[model samples]
Target: MLKQKSGPSRRKVILIGLDSAPPELLLERFLDKMPTIRRLVKNGISGRMRSCDPPITVPAWMVMMTGMDPGQLGIYGFRNRKGWSYSDYYLTTSTMIKEKPIWEIIAQTAGMKSCLIGVPPSYPVRPIMGNLISCFLTPGLEKEYTYPHELRDEVAEIVGEYEFDAAFRSDNRDEILEAIRRMTNKRFDLANYMIEQKEWSFFMLVEIGLDRLHHTFWKYFDDTHPRFESGNRFEMVLEDYYILLDKRIGELIENCGEDTIIIIASDHGSKAMKGAFCINEWLIREGYLKLAERPEGIVSIEDASVDWDKTKAWGWGGYYSRIFFNVKGREDKGILTKEPGGDLDELVTELKEKITRLVDNRGVPMKNTVFSPDELYKTVRGDPPDLMVYLDDLNWRAAGTIGHGKIYLEENDTGPDDSVHSMDGVFILYDPRERIRKDIGTMSIMDAAPTILRRIGLSIPKEMIGKPV
Candidate 1:
C-alpha cells in the first residue's frame, strides 16, 4: 500500500462534484456559458470522467468515495430491491452501503479530518472525525450541518432552511431554475462556514444542478439530436443556469483559502438518450428476462409505486448510466421470478452478446458493451444486481420521460426531473508528483474510490475489481 504521500503539497484536499457536467457540453458552452469551469480547465488538470457500469449516480458517488468498483460496493443503481418504476432507490441514510469508504480509511491513516457536504446518499454523516452536511440520499440530518447547529445564525442569514431536494422543481422551468439558485446560495454559505469556522484536512461538496439540469433541460441545451428530438424549448434559460453555475464555481474559488487543494468532478458524462430503451423490455425479447406483469400500461416508475417483489428490471437508474437487474433472491426479497444461476461468467458472455444486438433508433448497433453479473460483481457485502449493463458514449446516456424508457404523460408520471448518465468526469490528480497520465483513458465511476485511497496511502483489498485511477 502506498503510504500517504510524504509532503506538504498534499494538504487540505477539497473535492467538488458537479453532478452531471459533461465534456461535450463544456466544450460547446464553457467559454460562452461557464467562466468558472473554463478557468479550471485552463488552470487545473481536469477533463472527461469515465463512469461505472450502468453509470448510475449512487454507484458513481460510491466509487468516488471508495476507489472500488460496483462489484465490491454492491451499490449498482440505487435500491437492492425495487418498489415500482425500476428507478433505483433515491439513496439516503436508509440505503445499504457496503465497503470501507475513503472517509473511514482517511480517518485511519491520515489523521486528517474531513467535512462532507451535500454529497449524494451520504446520509447520517457516520460520526467521522470531521463535520458533515448531509444531502441527496440523506435527509432529516439537517441539524449536523456545519453552521445549522454550530453557526445557526450565520447559516440562517445566508440560506434559509429550504432543505436540499433533488427534485427541487415542478414542471415549471422558472420555478426549477429559481430553486437551483437558492440551493446554490445555500451551498456557498455552507462552504464559507467551513473556511471561516472549521479546520479540516479533506472536504467535499456537491452541486445537483448539473444532474438536474441535464435530466430536465438537456433537450433545451443541445441543437442536434445525437439521437432523439431533443433541444430544450427554453434553451436560453437553461444556458443561463449553466452560466450561473459556472459563476458559482468561480465564486467558490474566490471564497476558498488559497492553500486549499481544489478539485472539481462529475460522476459521469451526460448525453441524450434517444428514447427510453426499457432494459427489461429487451430482456423479454432476448429470452433472458420475464416480467411478472406488464406494468399495466406506460407509466413513469417514479410516479407509480412499484411492488418491489413484482417489477423485474428497470432501465433508467440515474445520472451515472446504471441499470438495475431485479433478480429473485438478491434484491430486497427480489420480485423477479426469472432468476439467473450464480454462474456469472457464462451469464456475462450471454448478456454482452444480447445487449450488443440492441440498436439505436437509426438501426445502428450500440457500442461500448455490457458486463455480466459475475464480471461486475465485487462481492461486497450487500444486495447487489445479478447482472449489470453498460452503454458507450453513442448509447449509454438515457433519461425519462425524455429518455429511452416508456414515457408517462400523467402529471405525476413525467415530472420536471428525469435521469441520465452525464459524460463529464471528475478532475482528479493521480499523483501531484507524477505528471498526470494524459491518456489514463476515461475514468470509470468505480476507479475513483481506489484512486482516492491510494492517494491517501491505503490498500484497496484485492477483492475489489477497480484500482487506483
Candidate 2:
C-alpha cells in the first residue's frame, strides 16, 4: 500500500473531462465563443496537454485517472488480445483496471468523498467511497450503472433512460445532431443534480458529445478538411454545440460554489481526418499477410480466410494500427522465431522501415511513426501488438478491411467519421482563491492525476511517473 500524509487544508476539486477536445479549437479558434472556458483560462493556468501513445479514449482517460501509461496499464485500446491466440480478445472494463485511480486513492488516504460520472471503462460499476455513474461504455440501461445501485433510480428520475452515447457516425446528420444535444443536456442536468444532492470533495464528469461532434461534423466546419466546402449546412453546428457546452459548464461551476478548484481537460485532441489507409490491403500487397482466397468485396480481416501458415504478420485498424507478428512457439502455425538476430527481429526491422517510408495517394512522403510497446512505456504488461503505427501523424486512420483493391480510402471503413484523434489536448486549471494567469505551456496527460492529488493536499504516489505541475 502507498503511504499518505495529511495536510492543513483540503478543497473540493471538479474535473470536467471533454473527450477529444483539441487545444487549437478550444484554446485558439473557439475561445472567444466559450465565455466560461475563456474566463477559466484567463484566471488559471492553461496548456497543451500531450496525450498518451495510441491516443484513443479508453486507455487515454484511464491513463489520466490512474497516472499510468497505456503500456503500464496493459490496455492498448478498447479491445485487447486475450492471449497469443489468433482471435481471442476482450473488451476492457472496470474489472481489468488494477491500478488505483485518484478517487479511490483520495477516498482511502484523505477520507475524501467523490461523485464520479462517465469516466471510461467505469461500467460494471465498482464500489467507491461515494457516488458513481458509469461511462458511455455501458452496454445499456438494463444493467446496473451506479455504485450504490439505488443511485440509478435517482439518475433515471432526473434524465429518463440516460443517454450513454450518441450514434454520431450515422449519415443522418440531423438525427445525430439532435441525439448529441439531448445526451449532453441530460448528462449536465444529472451532473448539476449530483453536485447539489451528493456529499463529496471530488467531482469528475466526462462529456463524450464533443468527440462525437468532431467526428461527425468536422468537414462541415473545418475549411482545411479534404471534403470541406464553404457554407455547408452544418457549418455552424460545432460552434453552436461549443456554446451550449459553455453554458452548461457555467451552470456546473455555479453549483460547485466559488471556492472549488476547477479543471477542464481532454483525453486527446481532434483533427480533420485526411483519409483512411487500408492497412490489411497494404500488408497483403507487401506479402506480409497471406489471404487463402481474395475477398469479393470489402470484408473485415476476421471474416476473410487467412492462410496462417504463410502469413508472417497481420494488422488491426483504428486511429492507429496494431500489427501482430506470427512468431514460433507464440502463435499457432507460427513461422518466425523470436531469437536474437533472427527472422522475427529482421522482419520487424524491415516492416518498420517500409511503413515509415510509405507515401500517400499523391506519392508524397507520409510522416508515419512506428513504435514497439517496450519503446513507448516504462512497463509492458498486456498482450501488446508487435508494432504500433501512426500513419501520417494520425491524420490518416488505419482501415482493417480487405478487398478494397487499393491502399487509400477517402472515408472511414466502419462509418462516416470526419476527424481523427490528435496528440495535443487542452487543459485549464482554476482555483477560485488564486488568480494565476500563467501559461504552463505543454504538459503530459500523466501529470493530471498527480497535480490534482498535490493540490488537494495528498502526497503523490511513489509509483506515479509524472511530476505535479
Candidate 3:
C-alpha cells in the first residue's frame, strides 16, 4: 500500500478526455485549425499515446482510469461473455468494473474531491467525493443520471437536457450534425458551470462528439478511404466539428486557474475503415462452426438453427475479434477436453495459424495479429476469450454475422460507420506551476491513472501497473 501525506495539497488537476482523438489528425493535419491545442503544445508536452491491444473504447478508458489491463480488470470490450456459452454476451456497465478507479483512490487516501462528467462505465452513478454525471451507458435521462438524484433536474434545467451521445449512424446527416452540435454545446456549458460553482481538487470530463463525427463522416474526409467520394457535400464535416470542439476547449482552458495541471488525452484514435472481416464466415468455412442447415439469407450467429454441440469454436466481433473454444467442463455442452494433443490448446494454435493466413478478395494476405490469454495478459480473470485478434491493425473491423456471401462485408451491420478505432491516440500535458520534461516519445493509456494521482499529490498504490510518466 502507498501512503498519503497529512497536510492539504494545494495543486489541482483537470483532465479532459477527447474520445477517439488521433494525433495525426489533430496535431499534424488540423493543428492550425485548433488554436487551443497549438498553444498547449507550445509550452507543454505532446506525444503519441499508445492504446491497449484491441483498442476499443470500454477497455481503453478503464485501463486509463485503473492502470490495469483488461485481463486484470475483467473487462475486454463493450460486450463481454456472459457465461460458458458459445455466443451469449452482456453489455459492460459500471458494475462490471471491479477495480477501484483513481477518483475513488484520490478521495479515500487524500480526502480530495473530484468532479467526473460523462466518463464511461460510470453509469448507475455512485456517490463520489464531489458531483458525478454518468456516461454514454446511461439508459436514459429520465432515470437517475447524477450522483445526487436532484442534480439531474438541475442539470437539465441549466444545460437543457444532458446528451449522452448522438445517433450518428442515422441516414439523416443534417439531423445528426444538429444533434451533435446541441450535445457538444450543452456538455461544455455544463462543464464550465460545474467548474465555476463546484469545489474540487480534480475535475475530469469526456466529450464524445469527436468520436461520433469520425464514425459518421471519415469517408467523406479521407481521400484514401475505400468508399471515398471527391467533392462530397459532407467532406468538411469532420474537420469543422474539430474546429468547434477546439474553441470550447480554449474557453475551458481560459476559465481554469494557473495552478491547475491540464491534461488532454484520448482513449484511442480513429482511422478510415476498410471493411468488416466476417469472423464467423471464416469459422464456418473451416468447419469449426456448425450450422443446422444451409441458409439463403443473412442470420445472426445466435440463430436457433445452429448446433452448439458440434461446434468446436466461435467468435464475437466488434472493433476486434474475440475467439472462444467450447472446452469440456468449461462450457455446459462442450465437446472437447484438455486431453493429450487433441485439446483446447491444440485447437487454439490451429485456429490462430489458419486465421492469420486469411486473404482478402484481391488475394493480399489480411496479416491479422492474434493473442492468446497467456501471451497478452499479466493477470487473467473472468471469462476471457481463448484468442483475441486484430485484423489489419484495426483498419478493418471484424463481424460475426453469417450469410454475407463472402468473408468481407462492404459496410457495417449497424449502418454507415466510416471509421475504426486506432492505436495512436493524442496526449497533451500542460502544467504552468512547474517546468516538466520537454518531450515524451510515447505514452500508454495505462500511464494516466498514476500520473494523475501524482499530479494531485496522491499515492500510487503498488497494485497499479503504471508508473508516473
Candidate 4:
C-alpha cells in the first residue's frame, strides 16, 4: 500500500513537457519573447532540473514519470540491446517499460482518470482511464494512434490529419516551418477539446517541436555557434516559435479552472553541436575495436564486417556514448572476462583516462568524464552499457561512424543535426489559488512525478525515489 494524504475535492493536474527545453534558452535567451512563461517564472516556482544520465528523450521521460532510473526501468537509451546479445538492438517503446507510470497509477490505485496526450514512447496505445494520443514516434498518421481506436478518426475529422512532428529534415525551410505550425496548432486544439469534453483528474502532454527546431537550426539562433552567420534570415526562428508556443500556453492556462495546477517541464535541454567524437574510429586506432578489413569508405557498426573475437571494447555514440565490453559468458561471442588485470578492467581504465584528456582544435580540453554503471545508477538491471561518457560538457556529441580516418568528425554521422541534448532541463510550477513556494531552487526530473501526485492530493508510491516538493 502507499502513503496517502487527506483531501476534499479532486482537482486536475496538467503537465506540459517541452522536449529539449533548457533554462538557458527559456530563462535567459527568450525570456522577453515569451510573456506567459516569463510570468510563470516570476510568480511561481522555477528551477534548474537535472535530467537522467545520458539524458536523451526516450529514457528521460520514462525516468521523469516512473521516478525510476534508467537501469531500474530496463531501458538505457532509445536503442537498447535485446537482452544479453551483443549485436541485436531495438528501439524502446511504452510497452517495454517495466514499471507503471504515474498516469496508470493514478487511474488504477486512486480511481482518478488520466488523459495522456502526445507523450513519447507511448506507441501501440494501451487502455487508460480516459483517452490517450501517442507521440512523435508513431509510425504514420494512417495508423491507429489514439485510444478508443475511433478517437483517431474523430481527431482527424476535427483537426484534419494529426501531425506527429514537423518535417525538419527537408531542404525547404518554409515547408518545415508550415508543418511545425500546423502540428502545434492541431495538438493545442486537440488538447483543448479533450480538456473541455473529457472528465479526468490528470492531463499531460509533451511538445516535441522545440526539440526538432533546436536540432535543425540551433546555429541560426546561437551567435557563438560555429556555423552561425551574421544577420541570417532564420535568426529569429527559434524565438518566434517560442512566442507561438507561449500563445498556446496562455490559451491552455486561460481555459483551466481555478482548481487546476499547471506544471511545465522538459525532458532534456539543447545546445549547439561543437563536433562529433567518433567513438568507433578512436577504438579502431586504440586497438580496442577490430575490423575484418580496413574499409575504403565510412561504415556503420551494423555493417557486419567487424571481427568480434578480437574486439575488447566498442561503443556507439549519440548525444552520449554507450560503451560495451565483450565479456565472456555475457555475450554470444564473448572474449573478455572480469578477471584481475584482464581486458575489462584495464581497458576501461585506459579508455576513461584517454577520453578524459581529449581536447578540441582550439586547445580547450573536452572537460569530459566517463563513468561505470555501478558508480552512477542505484540498481543495475537489464542490458546496460559497460560505460557512459559525456564530451566537452555535452557540447560535443558522439558519432559511432567508423572508417572516417580521423578521431573527430565535423558533421553528425546520423543526419543534418545542429544540436545535441544537454543534461539540464527546465521545470516550473504554477498554481494561482494556492500560495506556492517561490524558493524551490533545484530538483531532479524524477521529483516531478511524485510532486504531481502530491499536488493533486494523492498517495506517493513507495517505489518512487522522488520526495514531495
- Measured by TM-score, the strongest candidate is 2
Q: Write the per-residue lDDT of candidate 3 for residues 7-113, one digit (tens) a residue.
A: 55647888899999998887889989998888787778888888886587888888899998888988888888887865678888888788988888878887778
Pairs that collide, model 2? none
lDDT of 2: 0.93
> How do the predictions measure up, each by TM-score?
0.74, 0.98, 0.96, 0.95
TM-score order of candidates, top first: 2, 3, 4, 1
Superposed by TM-score, candidate 4 places the C-alpha of residue 415 at a distance from the truth, in angstroms, of: 1.2
lDDT of 1 by residue, 254-367 (tens): 666665556677777776654444444454455544444445556444544444554444554332234455555555646444535553335455665766676665667766
Off by over 4 Å in 2: 1-8
- Residue 43 accuracy (lDDT) in model 4: 75
Regions of candidate 1 where Cα sits further than 4 Å from its true position: 1-10, 32-35, 82-95, 140-154, 166-170, 226-233, 281-296, 299-352, 377-381, 391-419, 422-424, 428-441, 445-469
As a TM-score, model 4 comes out at 0.95
lDDT of 2 by residue, 126-203 (tens): 999999999999989999899899998999899998999998788999999999999999999999999999888999
Please give the distance, in angstroms, between residue 427's alpha carbon in candidate 4 and its true position after superposition: 0.8
Give the backbone clash total of model 3.
0
Best candidate, lDDT: 2
In model 4, where do residues sit more than 4 Å from their true spots?
A: 1-7, 435-437
Q: Report lDDT per candidate.
A: 0.57, 0.93, 0.84, 0.84
Q: Assess the local accuracy of residue 80 in candidate 1 as a C-alpha lDDT between 0 and 100.
A: 55
Instruction: Show the lowest summed lDDT stretch of 10 residues, model 4.
Output: 2-11
